[model samples]
Target: MASGFNQKNKQCSLQELAALVPDGSSIALGGSFLHRGPFAFVRELIRQEKRGLELIKQSPGYDVDILCRAGVLRRVRAGIVAMEGNFGLAPWYRRAVERREIELEEHACASLTAGLRAAAFGVPFQPCGGLHGSSLPELNGWKCLDDPYGSGQKTWVVPAIRPDFAVIQASEVDAQGNVRVHGTAHWDRIMSRAAGSVLVVAEKVVDSAVFEAQPESTLVPYFMVQNYAVVAGGAWPGSSWPAYAIDYPAVEAYMDKNSDLRAHMAAAPEAQEGNHG
Candidate 1:
């Protein structure tokens, strides 16, 4: 079990957190496009020059694009990678897929979530009817199995996706490492439970008593969190709702300057020191 207060006192740098993730490990990122993602941590991962990471997510944005462009990823299993609204497609991700730079596994969002849910419960697989009559099963090698009980109905069985690590950004975390997600949590909760290890970046950290005062707000208990750190504005450029809104101008600037990805990355704000515990 993780020692909550002890871990809270031993906060390390973001670099140290990034270093904890080894090369070639499958990693699940939190949030949808431009919403509550750990963008700063993704930047640190790139800064550390990590490589051969396998990324898993529902819908990704700049976080995954940066990693893909940095040549840090070996494969990506995602439902989609659009920029949401009028932002259209994520340019770098689209280019990477077009160029075949990284292997891609496209699964339906429901199937992907189901797989993670199964993993969280320590199940081998989850049966779903969502992929029926779709090419995804054949494309991703999902098995179509028949129901054993009298009914001859078939279901697509999505294998569990237990990642090596899950990195999530939260609205708040108590000293005991209980996380609170203010808005739509996306897949963070399930991914945290499904991964072998979990790391969280929070906009604020308060006393454990705060959670005790409002227990329903605690989305992830301390036992599920292996490590956590308070990183104000940690999501930067991506919105961490109820705390900060999306940096639209910054995103626009990024889109305009995206052709020089390395240069833009080099100019990104430095991550804070105390980012891991």
Candidate 2:
């Protein structure tokens, strides 16, 4: 049997990592819209022709949009799916949901994060005070229960969302598979622990000893990472924080190239291969 340390050191190619995710699996993607998502791994997934994936995210941008455009998603559970700031909505995702081509389970960002937290803690559900008066509970099938300790107050409880796989892109990862995220962790940290399998793709890979110098920088511990890959510009077209900026022109060009869903699906594999390369 492989030792614990050796198991944690399971580094592989992007294609090999993508192959671990079976079709129809529930997948949680790291990053909040335009930042630090495993874009290269996602591209590899598309190339490998996996389909019927259930996507979960706090706020999705290219990662979710591209997958939906390629007709790989069967359902989406997210707080929101849009290009942050001036970019507006993720066109493909909006169209798919609007056309009833894909099922959507929406929640407030905090609720989604809370659910992942619950999963990470191995709990049945997590209660939040938010969404008490909103119709989101009904729309998304979340439950509202009376607070046992409060003065007859109702609390909305979100069920745990333990996905089959969690794919994340980090600023750096050490040889032992400890991942580091420079800026915001978003929901990646919790999501990594919430998933059955975790894959970390890093902009750079360093020696395990590096973490000894600054342990606080280690965001995702090695035990939580099942597979790791070193892919430069792994989060291409999206910002990876302190390391690189979002490739706005590339993103715009991609959006323009795949504006038509039918055409994009027909040529997705070839187009994405070139894009990733």
Best by lDDT: 1
Candidate 1 CA-lDDT value: 0.81
Writing each residue's lDDT as its tens digit, candidate 1 over 1-277 gives: 2334564343455667788899899999998899999888898888888998999999988888878778888899998787778577777777788899989999888888989988999999998776767999999888888889969988889999999999988888877678888878898888998999988888877777778888877778887777776667778787889888888877776777335766666544443344333
Query: Which residue pairs in candidate 1 collide?
Result: none
Hey, what RMSD does candidate 1 come out at? 2.6
True-structure lDDT of candidate 2: 0.81
Q: Which stretches of candidate 1 lie over 4 Å from their true place?
A: 1-10, 257-259, 266-277
TM-score of 1: 0.92
Encode model 2's per-residue lDDT on 1-277: one tens digit a residue.
1123654347887777888898999999998888888877887778788999999998988888888777888999998778877577888888889998899998788888889889999999999766867888889788878778878877889899899998888888877788888888988888988999888888888777777677888888887788888777777778878878888866676688435544433443224443322
Candidate 2, after superposition: displacement of residue 180 in Å? Answer: 1.0
